[model samples]
Target: MTELLDATDSQTAMLADLVDSVRAVEETIARLSAVRDGMLAIASRIAVDVARQASHPDQGDMAVRSVAAEIGAAVRASDRTIERRMDAASWLVEAFPAVWAAQGAGRISAAHAQVIADAGAHLDHALHREAYAARAVEAASVESPNRLRRIARRIAEQFQPRTVTERHRDARELRRVWVKDLDDGMAELGMLGPAVLVHGMHDRLTRMARTITLENAQATKASTEETGEPDTRTTDQLRADLLADLVLTGSPVGHDSQTGVLGKIHARVEITVPVLTLMDDDPGASGSPPAELDGRFPIDTDTARLLAGGVTGWERVLTHPITGALLAVDRYRPSDQLSRHLRARDQRCRFPGCGIAARKCDVDHTHAASHGGETCADNLAHLCRRHHMLKHHSPWHVRHRRVGDDRGEHENDDTNAGRAGDLIWTSPTGTTYIDRPPQQNAVTFTEDNPP
Candidate 1:
């Protein structure tokens, strides 16, 4: 009974195997039929070429249009197959230097030889020769042409420049070393990009010019004294003294008015505020009435009034913690919450490649409102104007973490998060990439975590 059951089970298994084999054979037959038809068309076109060659004996043996068309059709029919063929040719050239050299002597187009040349460019000639031999041996051992071809093409591309512009730029930079020092510096300056470097140079020159002007002014003052006129304070020195006086002790006076002031006014005038001090009442000191404090101290009335207002209204606009050159306080109102958040997140712009601080950035909406995005904290990101514009207008996308996710999950998850959302960039060649989030440091952290 056991033997009979075993035989029955084997028979069933054999039947199933037979059915699978038949299906596979049918598929193969269909493929072959297609190939046969394509080959027949190619042969017909080749025959036409042969006839053309015979008819135009003096025209030189050029490829006939019909044959070219057929070849194009074949390539279009299977681009992957054509790529594999090219790859195979490349491998053959690498494996046999003599063959490559013969081909380079004008037997093939540069494109055909490039694949091999590129592969060899990655290594010293001797090592490349060895690699080619190893590849040949591997192909022979495996009996796989496609595998060998794929490996060769990949190796070639590893040494080839991805674009012409990159190659040209690299060559130019290499040649820069032989240039004159000033010329080399200028070239480096331009390489940094005109807009950035020019602005920076302008600022630096302005600072140096100001320093020179101050020095010249002081020297002029010394010369004038030597010539024996009035030894008056230099303009810069006088300005400095005035500024110091205003900072130390100036006060503002308010004028009563019913209606709000309008329009603009310009005027120049000067006023003096006497330095006042309380007198010490010492009966033991026998002296005449204490000399009056100097009452001829000159002050700019407009500046003094402005300073007084700043002292009185300081609490309303300026916070104790916020210290530095004062930026426009009003312009910052809309993004105050975002500023705080950015401080906590670290004040840097939250876009990869951007290091601008939150204070120098605009609060951008990760998900645009036109696309039904909300204006919540989770949807906001700090980005400098340049990066913000890139995100909004360029082929770049941004994504921020959802409210519920833990901070760690979002921390360096810029690409993944962007993919999960509607944010995805289609590159120029139609390839897609996710724009990464920016890194944060102390400034960004404080901006993100503002109290």
Candidate 2:
């Protein structure tokens, strides 16, 4: 208790000093944890080497398992976890020397290292391993593991072009959706499928959840005005009920003919299916690997066909194949053009370190529209409600700039020409940094773009 209270230093320094200490502690933890992961990898490599010197025929395998089991038992971990670490250790020791060094230097964590290993594990040796490591390590140094995984997968895809068919076949054979229980008496569900279809489903569900929630709120408001009652059902509960209703009945709850509802939900699913894949394509010539889900997930060509047949009309988005820069979309609503462009361009809130998806964001003008800011792509970005309010109500400032060929500040002409723009943020503390629009790295598939 005394030490805990002393942490505040109420009798001495101010609250800001206490906050600095906590921040310092976080850095120390990350550094130590990364070093510990590197040490574990070294230890795993030693175990494999030691096991290789076995005296008996089966001793090599036995030694490895025994070592893993012993470590797991000592650390109160599962055999699965220990064995995975053992494999990661071998992977790090052999091919990812730089990643291992970064781990030891506290630039990345074990989770980050493991993501790097998993990203390239599908490819043959020396297949852009050095390039992947360099790019992935740089990303891991600053980005979250999820972002690093996405970057690593993009890098891996460039080298694993030949595995497209095999990967799709594997995914088809391993297709599964399951549920499991958690420690708190709650249950969780999981699904794996073409990335586009999956994200589309998620996007649909989010919209559906919002739809029912707003209606329910309106109903509650009307009822309260009439009978003096309030709605106690939480939005999470409503979303869950809505999902169950959809899965079981193909229609969400709170729906009625009298409500003049569309009797359907609108989900914006962005996909990239090669032109040939959509035609009565040549089966002998392996179809383009699954259509990309929102330029990220893979939807097997067959499923893409199925989705195409089911939907009456789906929106199309175009991007530069070489640079992965979003180009254009079929715009039906003039008012929504700027919003859709921001979503397609940013894909997430542009706030530093924020991961809120752009679809659920407010398109904010970096320079206020009331102050002569033009309603153009370069001048706009996605910011969730909280961050959007923060930008306008708080001390934060954001500026949009297009870095031209000379790398100097130029006019927005370059971005208007389909190039990326840079966002400069100045913190209330007087520190400044640059943020770039998040886009997939240039993915070159030799099968499609044969040299």
Candidate 3:
């Protein structure tokens, strides 16, 4: 018995050592990637300078392509791929030096750095871009690349000199649709247009699929599991089928109604509007922050107002004037006060690094209700189905905490101050990670003023 206990202790120590080594290797890789990006950026600048100083200035594109090809051959990559990487590296290193440095120190990953660079790429002023990089890097340090994207976009919008409406007008000209053929007798269809229009179209499709699914379930008189129906398709498959049917025949499969699903079902989207933005008549004169679309990214005030005007239902969300934390929301319907507040506070899944939208998630209790957990805002959070199940069945455990509880650990970080709620998650390995709600209305725009 003594020998077996010693062996078990040795194995546990070995496993812990292996985990630490893996983490160190990951950090090393991130640092090396940042260094490589700097090198690529330098190479691109040199290539451009050489092309400009050459005997023929008009052939600059060809000259750079030749340089790219030469480097690609030595690196075992395609010339076009090398050229693309060179351009991207130049953009990242030049536009967001702070982000690059953060990545070099392994404070943030390459993916996080790229997301920051892309978010601020549209800034026309140097000061605005610099300010954006500073806050974006801070936010990216603690967030996954997916979650950071939304935060970065909001930060970028705050610094834009031109209003979102003007940008949206110019961007509308580029709206288009295309089809790409794929292997195995399949093809992908894509569309690029206004976010409001695209998201609405998708929402309509989802509602139609749900309607059809409910009707089918009623006819069978049982759920998919009990019926053992092999013909039953997933929600995604149903949406695709419905989309193809609607596009080709202007209706869904087996539809006989004159109005049809297309006419009956409508798209729904969540729009978070600032009172100033909504009330302002002049887009250029108003300094209000841009409205948020589906709690993901910024949208023009025009779109937000239009949606607000047309919609029959409205939930008035009141946020803190400074911290942007949710204070209250007017719930007209019964038992909607908690639901609306949770949705507004937790814009996405509260699971660490999860980016699934709140609308698609289930409101889960941090502590089980069956175990004496009360049904209140303090004990509730939005979590996707996957994470919700994991919280209940897996080794992971989550607890709700206020902002100041862990503020000391993240000294000099201002991102957490904007969150209305925070969750402390402990992994099976006993490592804890803090997940805070995304910052809402956290616009830093002092850089635009006269110093």
TM-scores for all candidates?
0.24, 0.39, 0.46
Per-residue C-alpha lDDT of model 1 across residues 56-172, encoded as one tens digit per residue: 542312223223222333333322233334344434443455434433342332233334344444344565555554453333333333444566556544534355466546545
Model 2 C-alpha lDDT per residue in residues 24-46, reported as the tens digit of each score: 67656656755655666666666
Give the per-residue Cα lDDT of candidate 2 at 381. 89
Query: Poorest 10 consecutive residues of model 3 by lDDT?
Result: 411-420
lDDT of each: 0.42, 0.66, 0.76
Indicate whether candidate 1 or candidate 2 has the larger lDDT.
2
Better of 1 and 3 by TM-score: 3
Stretches of candidate 3 above 4 Å error?
A: 1-9, 54-59, 73-76, 173-188, 214-231, 246-451
List where candidate 1 sits over 4 angstroms from the true fold. 1-346, 393-395, 406-451
Q: What is the C-alpha lDDT profile of model 3 across 1-451, one tens digit per residue? A: 5764656777989988999998788778889999989988888877677667865444455555545544554554655677888888888888888888998998888899889988887798888989999999999878899999999999999999888899899889999998654543245899999999999999999999999888887867755455555448778999999998877656454664765655556456688877677887974475677787667767777878888899767888876655566788785656678898889888988865556779999999888899999898888999987668657654567888754454433311345442337787665545555677777753333434421
Which model, 1 or 2, shows the larger TM-score? Answer: 2
